[model samples]
Target: MITCKDFLSELNEYLDEDCRDEVRKELEEHLDECPNCWVICNTTQKTIEIYRGMDPIPIPVGVHDRLLDALRMKSQIAPPA
Candidate 1:
């Protein structure tokens, strides 16, 4: 059986339905016996479902530009000596 840590590491791939069948079986088996992991996985799946159902709201152009500018400025900053 896979450990909780293993499940978490593959959580994103499993959630995305990008995992192989063998991996999926192992993850599902873990979820079956572990209540904590099951809750987390179930909740995450539900959240993803609702999130995907909603229409995406675009951020303002100004906000986008400022965010990009901040990233660029931060990247260009020299590390402290």
Candidate 2:
């Protein structure tokens, strides 16, 4: 049997329905037998769904170039390995 810690750690994948079938079955069984974990799983699943449903916002133009430039400068300033 999987422990509560393992169940919680992998709960996100289960909620996302992105885990392996065997793992999903284990989580399903755990959720069925454990009310606390069930509540936690339900709440997290809802939260992720809500976030995913939000509309995408466009990033300002040049932001990517600016970030790359900053990273380049930072890397240049550091000593060589």
List model 1 lDDT by residue over 1-81, tens digit each: 899999999888889867898899999999999999999999999999998999978999999988877877889854356
Badly placed stretches (over 4 Å) of model 2 are 56-81
Q: Which ten residues in a row have the lowest lDDT in candidate 2?
A: 72-81
Specify the highest-lDDT model's number: 1
TM-scores, all models, native as reference: 0.65, 0.63
Q: C-alpha displacement of 48 in model 1, angstroms?
A: 0.4
Q: How many backbone clashes does candidate 2 have?
A: 0
Q: After superposition, how far is residue 54 of candidate 1 from its true place, in Å?
A: 0.1
RMSD of each: 12.2, 11.1
lDDT of 2 by residue, 20-54 (tens): 99999998898889999999988988898898899
lDDT score for residue 59 of model 2 = 80
